[model samples]
Target: MPVAALDDIRAKVGQQVGTSDWIEVTQDRISAFADATEDHQFIHVDPVAAAAAGFGGTIAHGFLNLSLLSRMAADAMLVPDTTRMALNYGLDRVRFIAPVKAGKRVRGHFTLDGVDEKAPGQLLIRQTVTVEIEGEEKPALTAQWLGLIFT
Candidate 1:
């Protein structure tokens, strides 16, 4: 994607930036996340047990779902043309509202919330992200995400 002017990016504050393409949260992906995090909870790795427990089947971990924001942002975020790099600053708030079931598809809707000039050529950008689960009434998660953009 082509870079955008800083003014153009700033103008997007308080408006929806973009919606990312849907991403399938498969069992394999969940298992991989469980392995990486060493969190093999039944709800996340054991389908039969999870089904018996009323989750219907294995579900993705909340952190796994949260981590997917990186991929989602790459597909839909706006960047300043003079940017040297962008860094994950930190999240101000994050809430996992619903579980993401295995084999379900999810996508992110991003809205630019605020922007501050932290330093010369350095900007702190805040975005509100909502991760929607396909065919679900409620979103999987919502977060106030932060990024440090170095121009």
Candidate 2:
């Protein structure tokens, strides 16, 4: 992780900050996500059944892919040292553009969309994140993610 000054972070607005390394979406991962979320949909857990459903094989749940944004951000995004901690604020918008089937690789491209001071010590950080599925033309999803960092 890199600690950046507040002023330096402000300068990165509207620009891509970083991209995370590729992460393989394996069956185990999908299963784990499903178990954790109690979303054991057939398409997400049964390969044979999912194969017949036109997905070719079991596909990761859209929410499963969406939940990975945090790990992706932690891998590549820089945080200011003045910030004590960060919290998930909310998403302005999110779209599932494509399916993330099992055995595919994915990574996130993080862009600093905007930043605003929510209060005296907390700031709202807005970011536009694109989760790109490797070897695929279309992305898995795009979301306007928000976070509140307390200084």
Candidate 3:
């Protein structure tokens, strides 16, 4: 499944492709992220205080949810034979729709928005990502992401 041509890619509009991965938002993971980003917020790292404060448990950092895009995208976007390298171009829109509590499970759903030809052998793809948290009304995160693939 090499990178498709602009015309072929265009034909995929309105199509949705998805992959699900079980991700655990553990306390240790949250704590590590807090330390790495220097964001020692009690709501994210202090389980005891967070529980007492009414959240019932610690929460994951917003960026942690954002950072999972690559892993999720890898599962969703499939470019078989033709593409040699794929690079994260950037993101168009990103929103944290819900909180991801520690010890919860989350998964991602992807929908292809569009793909454009940037130059010869280069294509830019735009995809909408929805990260769902088990038993949650709102998704953990919703984002429009971009990628550049070279053939």
Name the candidate that leads on lDDT.
1
Clashes of 2: 0
The CA root-mean-square deviation of candidate 2, after full C-alpha superposition on the true structure, stands at 1.1
For residues 7-47, write the lDDT of model 2, one tens digit per residue. Answer: 99899999999898898999999999999999999999999
Ranking by lDDT: 1, 2, 3
Q: How many residue pairs clash in each candidate?
A: 0, 0, 3
TM-score of each: 0.97, 0.95, 0.90
Residue-level lDDT for 60 in candidate 3: 94
- Find the 10 residues in a row with the least total lDDT in model 3: 1-10
Between candidates 2 and 3, the lDDT winner:
2
Q: In terms of TM-score, which candidate is stronger, 2 or 3?
A: 2
Question: Candidate 1 on 32-101: residue-level lDDT in tens?
Answer: 9999999999999999999999999999999999999999998778878898899999999999999999
Candidates ranked by TM-score, best first? Answer: 1, 2, 3
Q: Quote the RMSD, in angstroms, for model 3.
A: 2.2
lDDT of 1 at 122: 89
Q: Which stretches of candidate 1 lie over 4 Å from their true place?
A: none
- Give each model's whole-structure lDDT: 0.93, 0.92, 0.81
Query: Tens digits of per-residue lDDT for model 3 on 1-151?
Result: 2245556656776677666677888989899999999999899988899999888989898899888777777666645246778898989898998889999988888788977789998878788888999998999998898889887
